[model samples]
Target: MSVWAAVLALIIERVWGYPDRVYRILSHPVVWMGWVIGKGDETFNKPDETSFETGRLVGAVCLGAFLALVLVVTQPVARLFSALPGGWVFEAAVASSFLAQKSLGEAVARVAAALREGPIEAAREAVSHIVGRDTAGLDEAEISRAAIETLAENASDGVVAPLFYLVLFGLPGIAVYKAINTADSMIGHTSDRYRAFGWAAAKLDDVANFIPARLTALLIALAARWIPGAVPGGALRTARRDSIRHASPNAGWPEAALAGALGFGLGGPRAYKGEVLDLPAMGDGRRELDADDIDRALTLYRRLLDVLLGATVACAVVVWVV
Candidate 1:
């Protein structure tokens, strides 16, 4: 099952790639579904004296329900669509929709372009898409730094993690992972409202992403060596050491590698809403970050895409021959 999923995913990526219109159409359903689920969770998200065990139980139930829906409901629906004259096309569309190779690059590139054109204002706008920071007062350097950090983190979350699950368990796995990730993003936090109940979602997401995030960092480091001006040697060392420094056990690896590759630092002192929180920095040395650094980061991002695509092909070949 895993091997077939990998082959199908690679075939879809190579043949159709990710057309913007296709993504727009497919993402609409996921986004709307996410919004509806998010609203329901919010409504039921009252602060109660729930035990940690209860929270874990609730999370388990929720996850089980999601899996059942995807396997029993969604897969049948996909097969129904596949029964059409061009059913395989619909299946490919569904598979491609879940993958984020193109979307990630385009999102990061937009930020880089925005920064290049308008400096601080451009950066402020771009930062909103990528980071959870107060961008209104951030200078050019801060905005660029935030964008780079987002690029690295999302490389794992948005791209590699989903693909990893898809390869392991097919569309059902990807759907469940996305649902859990969405739940975490919406309610998984240490705040008073979610500190207890959201623990399962947060912890599960952490577990799911653990290996993928580290793999993403290694791929990024390899990409740095391939790019013209990136410092792969230092980037590799910094990624290993600083990956555990950031508040997130997983996010730090990629961000630290990206920071070191570009000769800048990231992940220190961010403002959420209006409150400032002091966070540990990712890279060893601090250098001034600017639009040019963002460009370099994008270069590395593109290379990472290539690396991932090549890996997928290799995996597919191995599966086919075996």
Candidate 2:
């Protein structure tokens, strides 16, 4: 039943992609989580006064509280769904709302479309919405690189990690993972403001995403075989050699895999909040990325999503029969 629910959720999300009206009316689960994280930060994460040890404690306490709240809410909801007729469909819808597959594709596609049809400024605006790097001074190649990198990194965080948890531990699994991920996104950083206070959130997110990130890399490598001009063997080799080069323990896997897939360099130094981060490049391929490259990355992303969906269906069938 859980597997069927996952399948239904994937289908629903692909078809509807979380309508704007729905979002306007109900906000989103991620938004709800963000509000809680913000309040926690405001209350406990005082940058000037809070020491590293205190910040770590506060962060752990806040994360523990949020996890407790998620379990409390989702456990009963799962039970309620089990009680009612055809209630798994409702569970499926709730689960689907957590995924960003179609939305991610749409967002990346917008950057490509803007780059193709409009000025560099337009494409920059579109890419800015998805990436955290400084976009104000990016040229066309830089803009395309940023968009493609965001697409790869978020594919693991926004889609595969949630689905991985869903398959492993059902609704509560995904709920808990999303809460942690939301915390990481809201507060996780290296700035003095978040360095200590966001430690637990950031570390927990890394732990949760470790396996899924590697799985995403492998899947992206497999997807490269189907995309023209992409070399699967090179993707796998590059991922193995360069995944650890990025600052993050998890994000680099997918980003490196995608860089290799597209035969381009990514994850070089970039600015954030006016400070330049001297990050290492992921691939030794070409550095001259363009709009067409963005389109190719999207094709790989969509095909990877398809592969994940097909795998989900297979798992669901096995669970149903066994």
- Number of the top lDDT candidate: 2
Q: Against the hidden reference, what TM-scores do the models get?
A: 0.87, 0.97
Local distance difference test values of all predictions, in order: 0.74, 0.90
- Please report the TM-score between candidate 1 and the true structure: 0.87
Q: What is the lDDT of candidate 1?
A: 0.74
**lDDT per residue (tens digit) for residues 1-322 in model 2:** 6778888888898888888998999999889989988999988888789789998888899889989999999999999998989998988999998899999989999998998998888998999999998998998888988999999999999899998988787789899999999999988887889998899999999999999999999999888878988988877888899988878999999999998888999988899989898999989988888888888999999889888888999999988888
Error of 2 at 155 (Å): 0.8
Model 2 — which ten-residue stretch has the worst lDDT?
Answer: 1-10
For each candidate in turn, give its C-alpha RMSD to the true structure in angstroms. Answer: 3.1, 1.1
Over 1-322, each residue of candidate 1 has an lDDT whose tens digit, in order, gives: 4445555664576455676685576654457457755654565455575666676566556555654665775577555754677554555556656666666666767776787788567668867876777889988778878888888998898778877877776666677677777767866788877776677778888988899998988888888878886788778889888887788989998899888887778888989889999998888666568777877888898888778877876876787788
Write down the TM-score for model 2: 0.97
Candidate 1: list runs displaced more than 4 Å: 1-29, 48-60, 77-90
